[model samples]
Target: MFSIVEAIRQRATPQAVALVQKDRTLSYESLFQQCDALAAMIQQHVPHDPARVDRLRIGVHFPSSLDYVPLALATLAAGACFVPIPDELADEEKRDLATRTGMDAVLVLETLAGWLPEGTQKLGAFSVAEQKVLIQRLPAVTPGFPAAAFEGINPAFIRFSSGTTGKSKGVLLSHESLLERITAANEGLRIGPGDRVLWVLPMAHHFAVSIVLYLYHGATTIIEETHMGEDLLRAGAEQKATVMYGSPVHYRQLVEAPPVGEWTTLRLAVATAAALDAATAEKFRARFGRDLVQGLGIIELGLPVLNLTGAQEAPEAIGLPLSAYECLLKDDTGREPPAGEPGEICLRGKGMFDAYLDPWMPRAEALDAEGWFTTGDLGRRDAAGRVTICGRKKTLINVGGMKVFPEEVERVLDSHPKVQRSLVEARLHPLYGEVPIVRYIASPEGAPTTMELRNHCRAHLAGYKIPLLFSAVPQLPLTASGKLKRA
Candidate 1:
């Protein structure tokens, strides 16, 4: 029965600064009041009658802002499951999510009111005075609604998967499960009342484990809405931010930008949502004197692995499992793979997600018989039990009888001084079944010729792993979360 709202209340009574933006600061008391006010407004739309036919499902569509925190907490406090519809998504995708979740209502910024579907009632409006945000709501659609399967599970939030390769699924988490995840993640993060987290990732995608972890542990969170490196560095230094969570793209920008000031208070810079390239890690450490610790974050699991110890020594290793989880690598037949042999990464953890919202894909059907969730990632553990992720099992390239991972080749291309970023993919070849091709963004100075790139790869990789062709692109496609999207 651990409540996230109650935890925030206990910490905010001290009147500390809980959240910070450029010029906006939200004290704990102000944050609590906003959450309370929003909760009351939400209760007006949801029926409290015990005999109600379905549980309330509320969708939140807003940009990354300080107001987002209170609205989400308020939704949960009002006994409605919170589903975030990112503003970057296309209108059709947003509507599809709302329809699939059977959302009972939606809360959006006043400026975006016209985006809601037609034939929906305008319930009412509310203002968050502290953040100066006006919000409106619309009623849900009842298109042959099924019995509310979610009420039985009592989910606190429903998050969609990254959908890099296929349609996304809704991953459910209860209040208790969220608490467990924060507690477990903090065991490694070691956050406290004095620490401040510099956050730049999209709130819609990363709020659950990251923002919640800082709040639960009484840490301040400095929100930077823009991806501009100067803004991020200024806030981190001025606010004396102790920790930072960003993707590899953000880290690269930080490395390339000129120094703002000495970040004496910053201790940890975590890179998640995608693989960490060795080149990025080296440049970041060389410039800032801090290792960019690579971590693995899955929708089904909060954060099971982090490279805390080996960031400088083994920049590519995802490190060992967190204290609260057990991890192993298994071959396709469910047999344990030998040490250093690549296999699918499987994990069982206390903070694992509860269910999938799709009725056709139940939780039991998704997990294995042993209760271990088989992550589609492919990795191998060294003698010291450190795991290095090679690539996704679904994305493996087969050439002749050998298996080649694109990441293995992409790392080489990224290491080139003239290459900014690179993506590797498979192409059909009548002779070898399939061969790898490299698509890259070259540095403004000049890019090496294709033959030079191939020779560089030949020096580092086996002949089968060397890419057959190299093509220059303005930029490779990336998901909203900043993970490289391979097609």
Candidate 2:
């Protein structure tokens, strides 16, 4: 795999559309120039430690824009670790990220300049009257100077986990590991220069970076700042996006909207971060005339595995392992489970992260000697070698000694015609010890009764697996990555 900077330089072209946001479109050359300027400016203002000046840590808080991409690339060019703070994060959370990462400085768009925490220097997008004096007082970099040389093992990014279960942890990625994961995903998706990708997912997520692999192929990337259903559809149609990547929540919204008909330029769509239910998958095909490609990914590992092209035949399966990864299902005894038996899903991959940052503190843990990282997911492999995820190991419910997967009940509930959305959580039951309680959102005009949903579940799941209690909510809580919060 090529270094990210080298890949960008080689693939640069005049006609390539590097970014397409709401008001403007930028060419690859323009984007490159901006990155170069940003890199030079960053090098000038940020004070470098004598011993570690070659490597800096910069926190960036900005909306998705053509400018933001270059700022990120520029940070990497300067041999610095780029930490992206999501725009949706609370002020306290944003400050915590900066303090926790030991950021030497922060980069922000002009609008967000006031949100910077105290005791940190803020670099505005452009020089201003108030900021000019400070900008002038800093050291300057020579124009057109080359970026600092970095080894493949150098830290490129410090990405925070979604923190749905708890506080987010920072997962460090080296250039080699990041590149390997991009290569694996590119190979699995068969991404190429001709592909025009619409990027609507949050850029802070690892899966979003998967789209960067397209740069190596000289592909155009259309950025949608908002994940609103209308914005996604309009961008796809107007930009003629050939490929799109998003979460299941995004797909559900698109399908539920009024008819948009078939998208002529669309060739493939990838959905991750959450389970792509069969009903939702079918709705996507019916609305767009294309199957929403589903894959498995974890913050601990990049795109280590993906389903094959025709693997949508079993939409529930996570498909085959990529060349760089080996996946297995292990029983409680640590032995591989036989086909058709459920076990813990474990992965071994070249693209896997070196360690997981401690959520409560700053330390990390390396992988065990076995090389496999337990995914905390329960799954089973079929005779054909395809894997189907049952549910999260910790989220499983035990009902009077019978094992129950809340996801199974939730899927059944979501499949109901009147159900808009649903979530299944385990609750303590006096008689059963623990049982599944489902919280759902229903269509405003056509809501179904709890007994009706219970009957619906009976058709697909065993009695013990069905939710014993049901409640309605206006909307479900979601994490920063856009996945539903199970707890």
- Candidate models: Cα lDDT each: 0.81, 0.71
Off by over 4 Å in 2: 1-3, 113-115, 123-153, 206-208, 225-234, 255-262, 286-289, 359-365, 416-421, 429-432, 440-450, 471-478
The residue-by-residue lDDT of candidate 2 on 1-487, one tens digit each, is 3357656677678667777777687788877777787778878777566764245667666666555677678777766777787877777777666666656666665566555655454344464223321221112222121123222336677778776565665776667767777777777777777788888766666432564577666787788877777777877887889998778888878777654544678988888878877778888887788877778878777766666653458776787788878898888798888998778898887666644333322112354467778888889888778888898887878898788887777777877988988888888989999988888999877779888988899888988888878898888998765566766
Model 1 CA deviation exceeding 4 Å by range: 46-50, 129-148, 414-422, 438-452, 471-482
Model 2 local distance difference test score: 0.71
- lDDT, model 1, position 41: 80
lDDT of 1 by residue, 1-487 (tens): 4567787677554588889988899887888888888888888765556887545778887777777898888888787778888877767777777777777788877666556777666777666543333333444456332456555555788887766676667788877788888888888889988998998888888888888888878888998878878777877888899999998889878877767867778899999877888889999888778888998888788988988988888898889889998898998788878888899999988778878776435566788898899888999888788899998898899999799998888888888988989989999999999999889999999888988898899899999999888999898887655568766
TM-score of each: 0.91, 0.85
Model 2 is weakest, by summed lDDT over 10 consecutive residues, at: 137-146
| TM-score (C-alpha, index-matched) for candidate 1 | 0.91
